[model samples]
Target: MTAAASDINFCFPVRELESERVKLTPFIPDLHADLYFQGSAAYPELYDFIPWEAFTDTSDFVKKVIEGCVRPDTGIALYAVIDKTPTGTNPSKPTSANFAGIMGYTNTSPANLSTEISYALILPPFQRTHVTTNAIGLLLQYALDSPPHGLGLRRVQWKANRLNTKSINAVQRLGFKLEAILRYDRIFVGSKTNAANGERERAGDPRPGTVGTDTALLALCWDDWESERARVLQAMDRRS
Candidate 1:
């Protein structure tokens, strides 16, 4: 049986956001977990900036990421990215290569009308292509476009490991402004497989890994959307 979004207890209304270039659907573990795992297993470097590793197997992925982290109850909802832009220049139709990558919302707060774009991982084949730009632009539009077309959220944020220059640059390119740096953001449990590197835990500390990591915080408030939307679209339109 193909599992539904509810299987992971997704919090939102479960809308599929898309564009001429990409599609973002609620991630269903039973259907997507295996594909995501297989693709990522061969590319561990892709996860170097996150808190978790490339997952040993499908079961490990389902148990740790799907069940443990990205659940409605946990305030994190994931989506699967699908590439629709046919191969070739200036393609005008949908070819949908399937499973381009993954992205999600974290720390969502309807009351405050805020959310953070997190867990973005574009597979090796799709990186540096239209998939990333369109996927992010769709999410921005969905979160900031106001009622009748979007969640009308007041704010959307992007967080990354402070040491991840690539990630920091990517989000900033998408319209999020660097707000501040969070000191001692998280503990790496003395392991650096997922993060850039780490400093030893302080004296008398027991964690045994990097004492903690610094986080780069960035955001795009609703006020910035009117201008950023057009700018983001312009970026998506670039052929190069």
Candidate 2:
């Protein structure tokens, strides 16, 4: 039997994380999947760097994203990035929620006290806005701040496709330093020739006809948080 949405545990406490500009809450498929599918379908091209193709429907999102990347056993947490800033189009509804995107913590390790932030999908309408900055900033706080304030994780890692300059830029701006370039980081089954928006894998490889990618790994450690946290807040405060 399928467990109830609220009953599902992510191996970490699911809390409502927010800032003046953005809010991130646990993503419950029963409620947000349809909305996510509608938004994602409109901008399939946005998933150019993702290992898998754009979702065909809500069911596909649940089957692939939920079943694949978001595993409770693995301690992954998916969040709904909600825009909270007052839109000029609807000035009267200052607190209205506008669904912006999605983000997640993957490869979370409670014992090791680390996690990786991955799968950020900012909808077209919300791109290049404060949503991205505050959304990411909020997660950083939740993950790195000391107990009673936040999770106090020792490290937060971000892995982006080497070709994804925008993502690389975002993480760098948030104070993550480049550690290494992970070659052949992931395999996109059936891609056969190209590596999901990245360079093609080397030819004559043992696993022939497999699409792969090189990952640019960047990390923000507890040692850097005190200073970077201040920088992140200033960036999130900017209006664009």
Total colliding residue pairs, candidate 1:
1
> What tens digits encode model 1's per-residue C-alpha lDDT throughout 7-44?
64655565778677677877877667787887788898
- How do the residues 1-240 of candidate 2 rate in per-residue lDDT, one tens digit apiece? 233555355766778787877778777777677778888787867767776678788999888887665754457888877787645532122222477778978888999999988878888888888988888898899999999888989999999888888989988998999999988788766652333545544767787666777789999999899888999999989975
Model 2 whole-model lDDT (C-alpha atoms): 0.78
Best candidate, TM-score: 1
Tell me each candidate's TM-score.
Answer: 0.88, 0.87
Alpha carbon lDDT at 27, candidate 1: 81
Minimal lDDT window, size 10, model 2: 88-97
Candidate 1 whole-model C-alpha lDDT, 0 to 1: 0.78
Candidate 1: stretches off by over 4 Å: 1-5, 72-74, 86-97, 193-200
